[model samples]
Target: MDDIRNIYCVGRNYRLHAQELGNEVPKSPMIFSKPTHALVETTGQEIVLPGNRGEVHYEAEFVIHISKPYKPGMKVEDVVDQFALGIDFTLRDVQSELKKKGHPWLLAKGFPNSAIITKFRAFPGVEACKEVDFSLIRNGQEVQRGNIQDMLFDLETIILFCSQHFGIGAGDIIYTGTPAGVGPVTDGDRLQLKWGEEILGECFIRLG
Candidate 1:
């Protein structure tokens, strides 16, 4: 395993997700985080859900790969050059449980292989990065669907808000929020993410 520098996950960036989670869409972007070590990055990798709360959900996020120092007053235009696509896997039941108890999401987000990210590319322009159509198919049928525009927090705002309060720097990654329609993935399930006809990448969840 490699050492991860930092992990940042934006919260409630999608109006629908906020509404579904029973939170009003924020006038500004909300933020949360996972341990960098929590990132899951193996092709055909597997994830395990705690048997006690057996609901492991997948949250597809836009992964940003930084190449420069991130500081206060930094603009997305400055760091926009480094970006990619990925998934922010979450335990829906676990998160809900934690929320009820007013706990931070460390346990909910720090499990091994919790975050799965696909190979990133610069082919797509960053300004309207929402052009991608995101969908997750479990087994052979469709399960979750979302589009980039649905995000309540725009990318530029994300970069600015985070840098304002954070001592961010180069080589950091930010898992922007996921859209609505998130659900659980059990062992022996296959997950796919796509942008138009091009198959971005796919991952299968199995035993940890």
Candidate 2:
């Protein structure tokens, strides 16, 4: 088994998504983490759901994989090995209650199989990545569309910010947050993720 050293997620990195969720624009990046084992590769399996959670919302995000051990002075551009489209599944009902009580969102955000990923493509570095585009299609309709150019906090800043707290090392994965148009999924709903002309991955939702 391939072991993931760290799994870091940035919250509200997109202004539109933050506004859609009725959250104020953050002054800096809001960071959260998921256990490394939460990752589920989308190659050949469906995303299994938690039975007790009221609702599980799908958040389409761009994911980064760290290729080498990162030190304090390393540039974010150099640390990235590959890029892929990923989903950050959230238990919206649970998260709402946690927020109201001023509690951490552990169960709401970090449940097993909450992170789903596509096969990655080689990252050609930041300067060459300006025009990358990605979208999420649910049930044959486009739900979320995003361009790398629209990110409020660019890739370098997010990596640098996270490295400040925990050093980003090899096998670390960072989910760069979602764009607007997030919604709940039901059993039998199909999700397709695309990057430019490339089909990143696809999966079916199965809830019991």
Candidate 3:
């Protein structure tokens, strides 16, 4: 986690997630970012978040790590070296207000500890990735499940967009976006991120 540089994220990349939030499907990849300081690794520790701000929502996503400098027309396998499950925690109320006012989501999305990631593992090429499911389990029940095949904007497209616009390179990570079933998480909640049958990470939440 210490080696991580830029944190890029995709918004509304899942069609169902867009409709669930009453948002239109984007014509292109909707990109946003968080400062590196926003990152927190999930290692069975207590993850604290703002409690007075409003509802905090959990968005489970497939996180990709870039291992080499991106070049135009490079395949996803060429640039990406690892993958992991992550949570794009959001201050829902703050985000809603920001949306209504047509403002940036920095306040709601870029807070410290808002970006939660698990340990990274070797990237098994794109084909093998599409066959598995990644999910979030809160307490004991599954809340969100997604696969790379379901993304409205696939990895290749997302990588291209980010590279062209944000200058993606080694050390940058992309939170590929969440699926439907997003909801608030309260203090004392136990969150688990999984890829297939393997538990990538787990942590308890503490609102402060």
In candidate 1, which residue ranges exceed 4 Å CA deviation?
1-4, 71-75
Compared with the true structure, model 1 gives a TM-score of 0.86
Q: Compared with the true structure, what per-residue lDDT tens digits does model 3 show for residues 125-200?
A: 9999999999999999999999999999999999999988889889999999999999999999999999998899
TM-score versus the correct structure, for each prediction:
0.86, 0.95, 0.99
Q: lDDT tens string, model 2, 131-189?
A: 77789999889999887678889888888888888778888889998999999999888
Indicate the residue-level lDDT of 89 in model 3.
93
Q: Pick the candidate with the highest lDDT.
A: 3
Q: What are the runs in model 3 whose C-alpha is more than 4 Å off?
A: none
Tens-digit lDDT string for candidate 1 (1-208): 2534778888778777788779778887767877766776636555554545567777776677665676666666576455555777777777888898999977877776677776666635564566666666667676666676677776667777777778566667888787787777777878876655555677777744
Best candidate, TM-score: 3
C-alpha positional error of residue 187 in candidate 3 after TM-score superposition, expressed in Å = 1.0
Minimal lDDT window, size 10, model 3: 66-75
Ranking by TM-score: 3, 2, 1
